[model samples]
Target: MYEMNVEDRGKLTSNRTFLVKNITKTMNVVDKLMEDGTITDDLKQDIEAKLTDNDKNRKLLDIIPRRGPKAFKAFLNALVKTDNAFSAEQLSPGAGAIYKVSMTSSEKGMVSPEEEKPQNQHSEIILPKKWPTEQDFVKDFIVKTCSHSEKGKLQSDNYYKMRSKPRGRVLMFNNFVAVAHKVEEEDGLWKEKLQMRDGTEKDEQSLRRLFEQLHFDVEVKKDRKVEQMRSDIAEEKAHRFHKDADCFILVFLSHGSTEGIYGTDGNVLTTDEVKSSLNNKNFGSMTNKPKLIFIQACCADTYDKGANVADNMAKDMSDARKSMSALNLNDPKLENVDEADSKVEKSPSDADMFIANATTQDNVSFRNTKFGSWFIQALVYIFRNYACQTDLLDMLTLVNKLVSEGRASDRDRNIAVAVSVFESTLRHKLHFFP
Candidate 1:
């Protein structure tokens, strides 16, 4: 049945090319043998001879060490756990077949006969309804017959379980309160604050400590323009990752509005712009990879009004809306629009974007007089405590819960919050420490 046509066989002469071609062919052949039935010693010897014909093939053989009958059976059992075992089309589809094997160890005992079951079952117990319990009498004989017919016998039911492994690449991007803007305007004379009352050497130092512990390649930039921020993003995107990179994280702690963050000149830079700058042609492609962004910025539309006379009034959504409307009227010219909409308009469905906004559109993002930004503090705390033990989404959920429950003065009561998860299933829900 195995006839090689003269024209197709004539092309391969070089050892390297032949090695590659035959290795592929051998994989297909082995796949067919596995689907049809067990692989015998004679079949293994034949394949080994064909595979070892070239030096490159011989080296590949060493890399994928040849397994004996028991090992091969165990390997087959292992594959069932990882792949759709029953989906492979049987090579001898026309022939009558019996005694289907379960690939995974966990499912092995479930498929066994009544005699194979543990004797400690209760008197009221009935057999599983899938197959007839009367058929159990012939199972041992059938299994023994198959074992004698095939060279390889099935190993013990239990096999080693495959645990999750670590991916070695680390991603780190942190932005401190880097905006340098003119706050006081008197007769066109601009008064600048090099650092805001909340900003100082200690903020950046704390961030460096946290990120260093996380093993991030930290690079601190001061007072960057919007375009300079884009350039930094481009440079960071150039950091190469292996094919198995588990997760990526980017942290921005700056002065910002509902729609966008601020640059050095007080010009607004949108979140979509930041994300696009990292994904452009200048930056290396990161399609289908998990890209996490944590923003700690002031999303407040206007300065807070003094506490209401009735401090303990039960505020509903309507009250919240009224407060938001009043705030908007106070800052009509300064209200930022939907910056993320433009990107969505361009392409409705490009996944791998998860943005963690610091607050709801109406509320203000918080900054501490002593401790750095409130959102940043919550983030650092959660990442330090939970990032290693739980999934990123779960960890962030915990952060949001903690931040909302945190105590604050009436003047500074707006706590950190977040929303929006695009293509949730496609996300890599990994815990870096786990």
Candidate 2:
């Protein structure tokens, strides 16, 4: 390990505040540093002991300067490896280029030309390759998905028309707190106490920004009782603007069970009731338009113990089968309602609706107190980045892929994962085209 120079130490100290605020995925950085022998087990525990990401990052910055020469470089490498190359560049102007050269050259069985050059010859700095920002990622996907050939292949009549001045209205019900109540079940009587959903405001903000960017008139109702929620839904259904809109979207962020969502008063609002209220008979104006619903809450108390796949074919197959067996598909009763109408029959009331749940039945969805629910985070991110090029279904699929790969911890520190599920009845493709 090469010794970290005085200049690098100075840089780390001066940029402490910026690093603390921006270094997300802190555990990944800590793990890499530990693997590189830049930090001790004791130090790792101390860093993890801090409750928030900022505190953990502060601790990490404090410790690295004392870990000798290799610590600085190892920390920078970890940041770049964890999709934080922007931070690495901020710390050292050409740090990303240096790391990339080292990595790509190693794979090619050659030394980096930068490393081979004489010390004095490094006076001219090589500009690092531009790393994609969050907005850049969104733009790239839009450009790729809207290419001439890709757009040409789509049939005009196969997609829902989304060209309205304001595409539609979105109603979001964010229940951050629930009242305490005693309930009786078949098993026994139990007391239900719900805690405040911390960090939920962040999710509300994200959703508002996303929908507004997509040209939707967004309304958010927070901490409403069951009756209030029902009344709100009814008002939306009767709103005159629906006659000029292309679609409707509803979102629920609250504590819930397989039966339904919970209101701030601890009253249960059954999922069936929600669907029935938004059916063709009630929301007549949107009968043939798309109606989308997103629920971010736990379906049950169970945690998903994710499986690991091995390189060996036999072991991989065994893991795959075990995973398949563990999955429980909890399909809603209204999910299969037919959208096609014959001369002698009427289309189902639930036609053109798409329902998305954060997790499968009999599992709990994970949330970060500092960020938000894993499901919502992925949903906002994918929609923001891929909506221009991807249809609604494809965007939700990407959300599933992103959420399933995320690992979280329960109250007992057990490793838990989540998988998002969606059921769609729309006959045509739904695209935001934002």
Q: Candidates' TM-scores?
A: 0.45, 0.59
Q: Write the per-residue lDDT of candidate 1 for residues 170-262, one digit (tens) a residue.
A: 233233444434566768776653435253233454454445444343456666667777777666676665234434556565666655666
lDDT of 2 by residue, 1-434 (tens): 44567988999988787688667678878987888788889999999999999999999988888888877788878776664554686687556556645544323222223333422121232311211112222101111124443344345788888889689999999988864244777788665675778757767766765676576878999999999999999999989999999989999888777677878887877878887777776688898889999988777677876775543423222222111101112346644644565566555777788889888887887666655666776787667555655689988887888767655554454455679999888889987765
lDDT of 1 at 116: 39
Give the deviation of candidate 1 from the true structure as CA RMSD: 21.5
After superposition, candidate 2 runs with Cα above 4 Å error: 1-155, 179-192, 310-331, 334-345
Against the true structure, candidate 2 has what lDDT? 0.69
Q: In model 2, what is the error at residue 320, expressed in angstroms?
A: 23
Best by TM-score: 2
Which stretches in model 1 have alpha-carbon errors above 4 Å? 1-203, 241-245, 279-284, 303-349, 410-426
Please state the error at residue 110 of candidate 1 in Å.
53
